[model samples]
Structure formats: C-alpha cells, structure tokens
Target: MTEYGRQPVERQLPTEEARDLIALVRELADREIRPHTAEEEAAGHFPRPLFTLLSESGLLGLPYPEEFGGGEQPYEVYLQVLEELAAARLTVGLGVSVHTLACHALANFGTKEQRAEHLPAMLGGGLLGAYCLSEPASGSDAASLRTRAERDGDTWTVNGTKAWITHGGVADFYTLIARTGADGPRGITAFLVPGDAAGLSAAAPERKMGMNGSPTAQLHFDGVRISDDRRLGDEGQGFTVALSALDAGRLGIAACAIGVAQAALDEALAYTAERRQFGRPISDFQGLRFMLADMATQIEAGRALYLEAARRRDNGLAYSKQAAMAKLFCTDAAMRITTDAVQLLGGYGYTVDFPVERLMREAKVLQIVEGTNQIQRMVIGRHLVGPESR
Candidate 1:
C-alpha cells in the first residue's frame, strides 16, 4: 500500500538490465529522496547534496551514449526511471529532465571536439545545467525570442534576459539561444555558456505556488562572451535544435506527471484506509472507492501513452504527434487526479500536515512547463490537419 512505483504497472521492459535498473531507482528514491522531501520542500531547500549523490550513483545521465559518460539506456527505460523519481519528488525528476534538455544540443549536434571536451563533465561530473529559451516576451512563441548574440572575430558577445529559467542562479552551465540574424526562428543560434562567465547573472527566484524547492528565475547576459567553439550546431539552427530537444522533453514531462498523480493517489489511499469513517475505512465508501478507481485508471493510461511514444522514439519512428498527445493527456490527467485526491481527503489534503496538498500544487506546473497543455493541443491539431491560418 505504501510502495512507490509498485502500482501494478505492466511494464514491457526490453531486458533484465532495465528491470534491475528500475529496482535500483525505486530503492534510491525511497531511501535517499522520499524521506527528506517534505522537510526540505517546507524549507524551500534545493538539496544540492542529493543531486551530487544522484550523479555519483550514475542516475543523472541515464539516457545518453556511454562514450559520453552516460548509461545509454533507451528512452522507454529512461522514462520509467523518471516516473519513479518523480513519485518521490518532482524537484528531482523535473530538474533532471531540464538538465537533459540542456545537454541535447551539444550531444546531438555538437562537433566531436565539443562532445569530447564537455560531455564527460556534463553527464556525470556533478555539474548542473539550465535551458534558456523562454524570455520576458517569448514563451509560447519561443521563436520570437529577442536576446541577441553578435559575433566578433573568434568570439560572440551576448546581451539580453531569459525569464523563467530553472536552476537559474545555481546551474553550472546554461544552454543559451539568442538571435544572431533577422528576426524570427531562423535568426537564432545556440551556445553553451558557462554559469560563472563574466556578466552572467540571475535574478531572485520567483515565488511559486509549488515546487518551492526548485528555483525559477531570470538570467541576464550583459555582454557575456564565449568562443565560437562553444556554439552548438550551425548558426541560425538554434530553433531547430530547441524543437528537437522539446520532442524528447515532452515525453519526460508526461512521465513525471504520471509519477505525481501516482503519489497523490498513494497518499489518498493511505489516509482513507487508516482514518476510519463510520466505524470503517473511508476506502469502503462507494463514492470514494470509485474516485480512487478513476485516479488509478488515469495513471495507468498516462503511463502507457508515454511509454508508447518513448518506444516509437527509441525505434527511430516519427513520434512527434504521439508525444504531443501524451504530454497533453498525461498532464491533464494529473491535474484532474491530484485535484480529486485533495477532495477525497477533504480537509487534511488541504493542510500541510499531509502530502496531497503539496502534490496538488506541484501537479499544476507540469501542465504549464515543457510547453503548456494548450501548446500541446496546438501541436496535435497542426499534425492532424495543418498549421492554422493567420
């Protein structure tokens, strides 16, 4: 009844190794992450030490190539591990997803020299990362970003502010995108900027409704400079790189949503069983029981949807449409499920004494990040038909 990911999920793992990996993740989550989540979250502490532990345990770089200090696990297997971690704490799960997204450009499009020089440290060297795309005015319309990077001989000078950056002030590196040509998507180029570089600064973190343990703030690049060798992919290809990274990042968000929903349900189940109602467990009530059934059904469905998309991605199939669908449905389901958990627990769920309240708050950001649910629907609609008329 108190298990993390043991929700009777029918996993079609490709190998014994994958199954073992999931077991190890579950153990790590329960022992290392879950026990301290509530207290640290209450204090708004980021638990950087636990991240170091995750890196040391090889959990930080599971989905990339082995040559780059990664575990080389398939997306399907990697997402399942994410589900387990998210069930323990979203700060850890979502943080890992952002870090992986930050590394995507270099890993997929960087030169061999760039990969050999940076991948080892980024993957397992206990370095944290942040993705910079959204800005003060360009969030959903990420292509409209105005941050500019002007090249000067062998170096590039950057100046602009990026808003809503995760791990903002604390990240070891930033995967930055700034306009380098005419306005629009094609004008952008990607660069890997060291966090401590001159003139790189982060504003104070935003006061959020949830995920208080994680930082969300703006990054300012005031004449920050980097060599051309730090550029990722071709100039004017930054938007393409960003979109490609998002396709995989959407799946990661979907998995994390399911994990949050599952945790909410777990909390509801424990509370309903122990706190007797009318001389018996509230779990015996027909209405409450049916709600639990619905929650479980949604979690299972979301899990399957993300895994299906992940499998398509792993096999090199075109999975953008499915990924959009998964992100849309899974996050919507999580919002509904967590809200239901709060209602099922009645009063305690709304109080800090229980975990459901925090879960409900955390479930919300999942719907908004990695591309909002509305954006996901737009992606699905365009895939189904075609781009809408202006």
Candidate 2:
C-alpha cells in the first residue's frame, strides 16, 4: 500500500526508455547527491561538482541533439530523468530545468552558425545558463517589461535588470529578453548574453524560505554590448521565442513537481511503517491509508498530464494549452500532496529532522516558478475561449 493515505492506481508504469533513465538517475542521486542534500541546503550553496559529474555523465543536456554532446533523448525520457533528480534533490532538478529553458532559444531560434558556435559548450563541461525574462516590474506580466536593448551599428547595448534569475552570477551564459522595438510583447527580442560580458553583474543571492541551494538573484545588464549575431530569431520575435520556450519549460517543472511528491511519499511510507501510533503502526490506520491513496492518485494524474503534453509536443501537435494545464495541475497537486505528507508526519514533518518539511517548502516554489499557477490558468482559459476573442 502507498503511504500518505493514497490508494494505488492501475499502476501506469513508465516506458522502457523512461525506466532506464529513471534507473540511471536514481543511481546518480543515491551515489552523488542524497548524502549531501542537508549540508548544501543549510549552507545555501550549490554543489558545483554535482553539475560537473552530470556533465561528464552526459545527463546535463539529455534532451538536446547528439551532435552537441547531448543524449538527444526524447521529452518523455528526459522528463523522467528530471523526476528522478527532483525526487532526490529539488535544487538539482530546478537547476537542470532552468538550464534547459535557457537552451531552448539556441536550439529553436539561433541561426545555424550560432548553434554550431555555442551548443557544444552550453551542452558540455561545467557550463550553466540563466533565462532572463522576468524583470522587477514584470513578474507575471512579462510583456510589460521595461528593459531595453538598442541597436548601435553592429552592436546592441542592453540596459535592464532581470529579476529572480537562477544561476544569476554563476552561469556561463544567459538567454536574455529585452525590448528592441516598442512597448509591448511584440516589440521584444531575445539575445544570448555571455556571463563574462562587460557591464554584466548580479545582486547578492536572495535569501529565501526554501530551495536555498539554488541561488536566485537579480541580474544587471548595464550597457552590455553584443554583436548582431547574438540576437535570437528576429527583432520582433522574442515574445514568440519566450512563450514557446516556456511551453517546454512548464513540462520540466511538472516533472520536477512529481519527483518532489514522490520523494515525500517515499519518506512518508518509510516513516509510517516504522512509526507507531496507539501502539500500532500508523500505516495500518484507515485514515492514513486513505490519505496515502489520495496522494498517489494526484501524483499519477499529474504525471499523466505532463506526459500527454510531452506526447503532443513530440508529435509536432499543438500543446500550448495542454502544457499550461499540465504545469498548473501538477504543481498545484504537488503543493497539496507535499503539505499533506508533512501533516501526516504529525510534528516530525514540521522539523528538519525529517525530509517532508523540506519537501513541503520545495513544493511551494513549483506553484510560482516556470510561470505561476495563476498565469497557467489564464493561458489555459484564453485557449479555451479560442484565439479570436483575445
């Protein structure tokens, strides 16, 4: 029986490829990450060697093309890898997801020359990336951003501060969006900003309630100059690129959410079986059994939602609405399930002595990142009304 009051569903298992990826990720997690999770979180520092190990293992660029030293894995297979990583450590899962988000621009919009020049380094080594779309004035409403990028002969000078950038100071490169035309979304353009560019800097990392191991900071781009070759797609196509990248990014977050929930469930199951209440194992209580059943049900549904979206994406079918739905449903489910997992732990869950509390905190961020759940709902609602009305 699944713990945390969840009943087992029909057992919708992963494909053979997904199972293989999951097995590999589990081995990596157990061998390299799980032991240091507490130390890393307490110190609010990321483990650089972890990323280097991932790069060496060919896991950092799992979803990219093989020509760039990536595994060229399908989205279905890639997401399971994310789920396993997240189940072990949220910081690592999010780090990989954020890197993949930054990579989307180069993969989908970069010129062939740009791809040849950057993809190898970005996909290999210890290189990391940040996606700079959110600004101080534009969190949920990204189109209202005030950052500007002006053309100067052969160079573009970028002037703006991007808010809540992951790997802000430490990234090797950034996929930056700035205003190159007018005032709205249509006027924006994407640029590949190397982290070593002059005039580029970051604020000290934000002190947050959770996920401390993943640094979050504000990025400053003050008159940072880039050649025309850095522009991603056309001058007016940044919005398209950003939105498209987000669709794929959302799936990554959903997978991460499931992984987090699974970890919580795993811990809860182990704890309850060993933990006794009223002189009996709490896992034997019908109330706790029901709760575990519900948690498992929700996780399965969340997994199904993301997998369906990934399937559509893989088939070259329209998946914007489905992607938003998956992200919204899955993250929201994670918040609920992880919270209940802590509740079921009954006091121990509220403390650092157990992992459920950390899982609960990690779950909250899922609802806010990769486009807030509110934004996801709006995207889904808009699509439901058809594109003509808006």
Highest TM-score scorer: 1
In order of appearance, the predictions have TM-scores of: 0.97, 0.95
Which segments of candidate 1 are over 4 A away from where they belong?
Answer: 1-10
| Global lDDT of each candidate | 0.91, 0.87
Give per-residue CA lDDT, model 2, range 1-390, as digits (tens).
Answer: 122332222323446665666667777888798788877787897977788888888788888998876778878778878887888789999899999999999998998899989988888867888899999989999899888999999899999899999899999899998999988888999999999999999999999988999999999988899999999999889999999999999999999999899888877877878899799999999999999999988988899899889888888899999999999998999999899989888988888878788889989999999889988888988898855343
Model 1, 151-220: lDDT tens digits are 9999999999999999999999999989999998999999999999999999999999999999999999
Task: Give per-model CA RMSD.
Answer: 1.8, 3.0
